[model samples]
Target: MDKLKGKGKEAVGKLTGDRRKESEGKADQVKGRAKDAVDEAGDRAKGVKDSLRSDDDR
Candidate 1:
């Protein structure tokens, strides 16, 4: 979602030389950064879950 928004903003900025478009791109980039952090945390959670499941199997 954030990535899509960021790409759209970036493309629009490139197409148009509007200051608002550039600002939008900056905002989207920040959103993307937050999304990346969330994804990393989710991945860590999944890894812990998998490790626990494997231990149970053993």
Candidate 2:
């Protein structure tokens, strides 16, 4: 969502020649990607923990 919003803002900034908006848009995209990475890591950790629990049952 943030990435999509950033893309739109970046496009608009380019059309309107606003340097600040363009930089902000770029920052938003980076933030979105970082959030996605953290979420993925958390999910992987949960999966590992679940597997460990199942192993204990056996």
Candidates in order have lDDT scores of: 0.82, 0.89
The global Cα lDDT (0 to 1) of model 1 is 0.82
lDDT of 1 by residue, 22-53 (tens): 67877888988998999999999988888888
Count of residue pairs whose backbone atoms collide, per candidate: 0, 0
lDDT of 2: 0.89
RMSD of 2: 1.9
TM-score of each: 0.59, 0.88
